[model samples]
Target: MPASGSVSVQSLDQFLAEVEGRAFQIARIATGCDQDALDIVQESMISLVTSYSDKCESNWKPLFYRILQNRITDFHRRKTLTGKIFAWIGLKKADEEDIDLLEQIADPNADMPELALSKDRFSDALIHALEQLPARQQQTFLLRIWEGLSVKETAEAMQCGEGSVKTHLSRATQTLRAHLEPHYFSGDHHES
Candidate 1:
């Protein structure tokens, strides 16, 4: 292989390695299941490597995120379809295990029980608010706020116009604020 080709491969590997953990977290939040999140991240990584490895390095972040979003959408669609089928078949489905939101927080030493409880409450409220958002709003908020994408980049990732991204973000923020305001500002961090 040419030296340039080798360099590109190395760069791609490093990029994937660095983003994999956060991508998994994003997928986990979107899917609400550990195994499904793992599958989505794996599939997104493979899709990016197979289809978009040749793109410019600067373009990789948005592209990878776009792919991840698509994978999450696909996962949700499959889940819904399967659920409908199961209902029609009169079959009982097993309950899904709960995923710990605080596990995603980067705290290697969680020695303080009070701090841990506070974080747990915040994480629960945040997750509930996020899950209540409309799909487009959730996508826009996650890409723009959580991932720190520009409006243009977020629009590109969601395959929408910049105005649409902004509108969705505005609605998402409003809804989140309404849902979380009481819990956030009431000074009730302790889980009673």
Candidate 2:
């Protein structure tokens, strides 16, 4: 945990393990595809190890997130470019691949079915709400609030000013709260 020395292999492995789930979640929220998200997270982790492993463990969090953010951006750009090129060539994409993530993760190995079901639904709703956010807002909220990074660290990871990070987080929080409050807190569902 030195300020400048490279982390040991064990420490690096532990760090990757600790952040893997959240990283996957962040990438998933960004990509909206389970396989794409997994690829982005893996690429980000490898990029971090190859490029920034020489940095200190203390620096890894922000650096790894920055790499992740860049990778997500790159993924989107590539998708867009590929789509345009395909259209130009008169080639069309395959059928839509909308994945029901809830179904994909429904069978959690939890002993308490009631609690697990409720928690899973809420988590799913939260993720859906997150998907509705703008890119900057989503990244800011994930890095600053969900991932427990400081404002300064989030700013660094997002390549934005601290004020921008705060603004994005505020907007994202309000949007998510408005989206999820009624569904979770109301006494009755307002089914349309």
Candidate 3:
């Protein structure tokens, strides 16, 4: 409440708590690896706090997303590089299959478990469609539509021009529409 950049500790903490869940969702979608997504989200939060916490509350969304976007990009880069190096070395990286017992059998809170499993038909379809999109398109759609960032704010967060943001969103929308409309309008929404 002091100024844009210099928010009180409580305010900043509140902001992080509010955004963390959505950030994790976005990161999970982008990375397709839970542990990597967790690391990226945690690193992004730390980055926003260490580097830009003084920005106004209004500015925090774009700033935080900018950090998130960068972290995700770095992750993709590292993944690509690792894949290349392993291929060059003639070693196939084994998929991670060691599951923790707690993680496997833990009972999350009731609503959390239900909400995670029981997406409505449309919600499930939308998430499926979203997963098929390319990374930039997915990021653009999520930031602009899902996250409710304006064109300008999305541009700032994405480190791209507004025109680029518009192009990405338009392409993503078209793809999602093409992918979802048929399924949605079909007999998929009714209960037996």
Candidate 4:
């Protein structure tokens, strides 16, 4: 086929191949459902191709991350609003179980035994503890610590001040520490 534009299909394929896994990881954490996460990633890919394909390649990472985060936040807002409306209509109970945000934010691959071999019960507890964190805190923790993004990059992706990023990360750390204190510092815990 004749070339239609300056941005070649090869370049787009390369970009998608490089970032697809991490994009899915971020979406999974943000949405808590694998299928929803996949949808967000796919949508983000479409948006990137449609709107920003002509931009310089160096700008792709932040632009993609920003789009992904916005999509995730929108999904959460819609879900929350719908739940509230349902409750108001007496179609759902107000006392329904709260979602574990931290568990939602954790990378699914991290659950593998190669990373940590905690008993199934301990792993389940940890997932529960993570789910209890606020959305921003969980995002901060995952982007900064898990994805290894710098503070500035994380702030940009989150569309927040650096101070806000630090605050969220600090609060997330404290909450996780408190939740894991008994296991983390106990004598039974072995240092690798």
Candidate 5:
């Protein structure tokens, strides 16, 4: 209806706005700390706006995710290196800040009674299972399943081959099933 360039820009703006919340959530999952997640998401947003704004709208999803993934990986790398150095110098503390499992679990609930309780359990189990997965598998599962990206789009976002994405997704799904089946499918409140 409008000029093509104007339409493209408008769509891009809409796309970014829609994805921003999800991107922050994804970054938060990747980074255990809230502050780190916020920083990573902000940097990724800036990078995407500056470098990839000219990209086709169709290609923006994968590009934005790839940038987010790179930022997450960079944060992990820096943290790992800093920890190593601190350990080498005997400056690292014996007890690090423990992430509370219950607190980390998202409560996807409202004032509803039965639905809230059941869904909360599932959400907790899902987040725990996801946290146990390797970084690549976690990324693949989140991109492919949670985000509903195609295998090709996931591959691009992960900077890997399609086969690799499939492999990682398969492994992640199997691991999640193993972790969740006893509690969910069996109807048993097995304490892990």
Candidate 6:
């Protein structure tokens, strides 16, 4: 291979290694389907390699995320449009299910205490509650709180306005608090 081609390959490999997990997480949140998420991530990887391999390394993360986000949004749009058409035609099956929200919530196993502690239990409960939020809200909350990104950065990654990011994060926090409040106040014993 030519030197330029070899360098591009190395850059693509490095970019994929660095961002694969994050890319998958973002795609999962956006698509809400594991298979779809995987497909989108793979597609994004290929797209990045094909289109942006020659770009500066510093520009890779946002560009990769932006491409993945667009793919995810496209999937949502197609799903919505299909659902609408099927519903209009009265051909939509009641049993047809989309993504399961509960499974999408971040597990607190990595952060939770092994010993039974109220605060630990509360945190786990909160994490599960966060999973129950809408996809966009969960994304915003995680990007802001867990990822520790500034509002502008989160907005840029999410391809949305800063105001929208703030709104989503606000709603996500409120939803999580409301869902966790009962368990938090009840002093219930959480088994380790």
Best by lDDT: 2
Clashing pairs in 1: none
lDDT of each: 0.85, 0.86, 0.84, 0.77, 0.81, 0.74
Report the C-alpha lDDT of model 4 over 1-192, residue by residue, as the tens digit: 425545777888899988888778667766767778889989999999999988877777767777888888999999999999998988974453434332233556575654454444465656556667888897788778876778888899899999999999999999988998787557443533
Which digits, one per residue and each the tens of the lDDT, describe model 3 over residues 76-113?
99999999999999999988753221112233645564
Query: Judged by lDDT against the true structure, how good is candidate 5?
Result: 0.81
Query: What would the C-alpha RMSD of candidate 4 be, to one decimal place?
Result: 5.4
TM of each candidate vs. truth: 0.86, 0.84, 0.84, 0.73, 0.84, 0.69
Q: Clash totals for all models, in order?
A: 0, 0, 5, 6, 0, 1
Task: Give the per-residue lDDT digits (tens) of candidate 2, residues 1-192.
Answer: 445455678888899999998898899898888889889989999998998888878999999999999999999899999999999999998866857553344455577666676666678789889999999999999998889999999999989899998899999999999999977876333222
Worst 10 residues of 5 by lDDT: 98-107
**Per-residue lDDT for 40 in model 1?**
91
TM-score between candidate 1 and the true structure: 0.86
Q: Of the pair 2 and 6, which is ahead by lDDT? A: 2
Model 5 lDDT tens row, 148-187: 8999999999899999999999999999999998868766
Model 1, 70-177: lDDT tens per residue?
A: 999998899899999999999968987775642455565588777777777877899888977878898899889988999999989899999999899999999999
What does the lDDT come to for candidate 6? 0.74
RMSD per candidate (Å) reads 2.7, 4.0, 5.0, 5.4, 4.0, 4.8
Top TM-score hit: 1
Better of 2 and 6 by TM-score: 2
Candidate 4's TM-score reads: 0.73
> How far is 74's C-alpha from truth in model 3 (Å)?
0.4
